[model samples]
Target: MPVTDIITDEKNLTLTVIADFAHPVSRVWRAYADPRQLERFWGPPTYPATFTEWDHRVGGRALYHMNGPAGEKSYARWDFVEIEPERSFTVDDLFTDEHGDPAPGMPVMRMRFAFEATDQGTRMTTTSDFASLEALQTVLEMGVVEGTRLAMGQIDAVLAGLREWFAGKGTRMEVLTDTLVRVTRAIAAPRSVIWRAQTDPVLIRQWMLGPDGWSMTICEVTTEVGRSSHFGWAPDPGVEGEPFGFDDQLLFLDEPFRIVTAGRMTGVEGPTVTNDLTLTEEDGVTLLTTVMEFPDAATRDMILGTGMVDGMEMSYARLENLLLTRPVV
Candidate 1:
């Protein structure tokens, strides 16, 4: 949220976003050069952007699509016009169709990006030039200023090292959008070991239990895509609570790295949420990131209000302890 100035000039037919950050110019520039990092905050928290093609050189165009919570996509193409590493760059940004072709009737905006070093750190200025006042107004009405502010607010987390920023934070949850939420936790375990602890039914039963008073009654796992996994838990002997389970269909599986699933409460009828779980390891610590897409904002809030993150923190802590005492084979 370091935005200092948001300017709209009717005579110039342009809009600009200016922000300052406490980082070197080189470091701030890499955030845009790397697609993996760029996608982290390019769009608003709600509609996350995914780059399908990345070519940063002049005459090359980058293609990306922002995914909406309800399975909608808004595609964009960026044609690089100029490049001066760590100094300045320009691009002709356009709304595009699924095929990356310019969508008819969409106004193309010429964007200039400038980076400069300051006493505190770095400053970034982005200016968008439109063909006419009407074109500028069109994007203004699209909530471009607010969305850019919120998106830029995420730059701090991206600038900090993952371990430095998130370690010891138990569990972190962010409402990305009305129907999408992101959760993250850092585990002091290797990537493969953590993956096995999650997917192996035998290991799962050991630490997947929510709390001290619960026991995993059912631990069914499926490693293959297009399969189903089921998990159930019940109160331990003498404990007072109802048994519950989750039914999940595996849609995508990348061993030791990522998995995507459609999950719903077992025996309960409604919509199935899409969960994308990814693990990245740094310095022997695995960062667990889960992006959950719910059916609606209400459904998202309901589950979060149920102490879901608290339960997850308990399970993750148990998993960490189990890993320490009983190292994976």
Candidate 2:
């Protein structure tokens, strides 16, 4: 039950995480070196993980598959550089293809993990080295620190449960089997007023463009379950952006009450994404919730890095403002 601290060396472009656990050396070591254990905590809370080619020996390698909320998948790799049983190990970690082919950039990571004997358990120090300060900044700016911490916290719970089971005690550990981001926003208007803004292109033009730096380029609807629709976005204020639009399959709907759509972000050709939008009414207020399921952790991380959340937040703000300005019809 020791503390954990994540540190950054701005000059050397290094990140360090120090943690302690009540588990023995063997248990803690397995948690990091075992593929099954590693897979249980590799990605964010939202997705299930799969690992392959995991050989935890010196010079051996491994690949992992991260399945995202939308059923899309991304891959990562690790080449073990050094391994000392129950003590420490070092590896190169990065995004890669299933065959261990490196991805688009030289975003290589040198990771060193050391375990020291402590009074009751073990102290683990994990450090990562990047190519440059810019690369380190890039990951941090992409919310890697927060995301990794959340994943590791899940690991901690698993380890704790193992300890409890070993001590002949009942361990009730909860692994987040699934997580959905349900966004809820209230518009102080009748359900029909909000529905009009959602359905009427004229009313959509008033607020859906999202002010500046965001514009909806395409909006298509089929109004059927197997049928599909598309909506595109552009950064330009007025002009439509190229390749901006979604190809969405209508999954379910309860009219102005609920909607479930599956679609991908419009691209020439790549992975597909699915999103669900739900609408509800409460005491003369309209609530809208959007839940997007990504294909994998890499895609999700990439989308987050690309500032999608900021745009969504701004769009929500504009909708709220527009609703306030327009009188109830």
Candidate 3:
């Protein structure tokens, strides 16, 4: 577990927290730089934070809201004053309205984050200065310390996820040309296991769900090179609409390592897309890469506009969890 220490100086109207992460500086730095990663640990676990706007450079601003368990939300904003890459950054933090404008009668704080590399890992120190001791005391009464501690405690899990992604063992997305999108991830499962998960309808149904409340209504896979497969997804219950899915013809197959397919999305106006999937094993981990080529940039952009990147990230995350928890027979 990482160690988090909090210190306060009423006279100086400052609160400081020091913590160490068992990850390299770059890996730890990403928790603050990446908006999606920041959302995972920015607030107490119960009140998850979502950033609607994020810009981390100097003079940039961020607008976010923390959603409480009881359908409540607290909006906030940050004005970045300075940023030093993987080293340090300073920001002005303040309470904001739902529209991201600063809230009246709210105390503002200047916060600084410093990161240093150590033999064990990266050490991070955060200091927040209030305009007056009263402001500091007020926030303390609001359980700031404990809430912050709980939030920071989640960094370890984020660091682990980032390590896999950044260490060449996690998913990477690239846009090759205007019509192609490539995604790759490294899994800590055997090639055979991963191959089965891709081709076996039973296993596919477990990891192929689009998002929460979405389920696969149909899944069929044929390992033969000339055969075809089909999969479909239905939205959450009570939704009024037909399910959407895809039908694909397997063009190539290389046992447990490679597969190529040409598929068309059902109930959607789009050109047929070609999918190329490859798997490689190194040590005990297997790396999976997927390439999707569309007929035109317009089609690709239309799909990208539908939060495809975030959806894919969530889907891959669920797959990773499944691989870790499900017993492989």
The C-alpha TM-scores of every prediction are 0.78, 0.51, 0.52
- Tell how far residue 302 is off in model 3, in angstroms: 52
Best by lDDT: 1
lDDT of 1 by residue, 9-101 (tens): 989898988989888999999998988888877877546688999999999989999865434689999999999999998999999999999
**Predicted candidate 3 versus true structure: per-residue lDDT over 208-325, tens digit per residue:** 7866778888898888766789888888777655678888888777677668788888666657777777665655677676777788999888877877667666677787799888
> In candidate 2, which residue ranges exceed 4 Å CA deviation?
1-3, 162-329
Q: lDDT at 62 for candidate 2?
A: 86
Error of 3 at 131 (Å): 0.3
- lDDT: the better of candidates 1 and 3: 1
Clashes of each: 0, 11, 0
RMSD to true structure for each model, in Å: 3.8, 15.4, 16.5
lDDT of each: 0.86, 0.67, 0.79
Q: Alpha carbon lDDT of residue 221, candidate 1?
A: 95
Which stretches of candidate 3 lie above 4 Å from their native place? 162-329
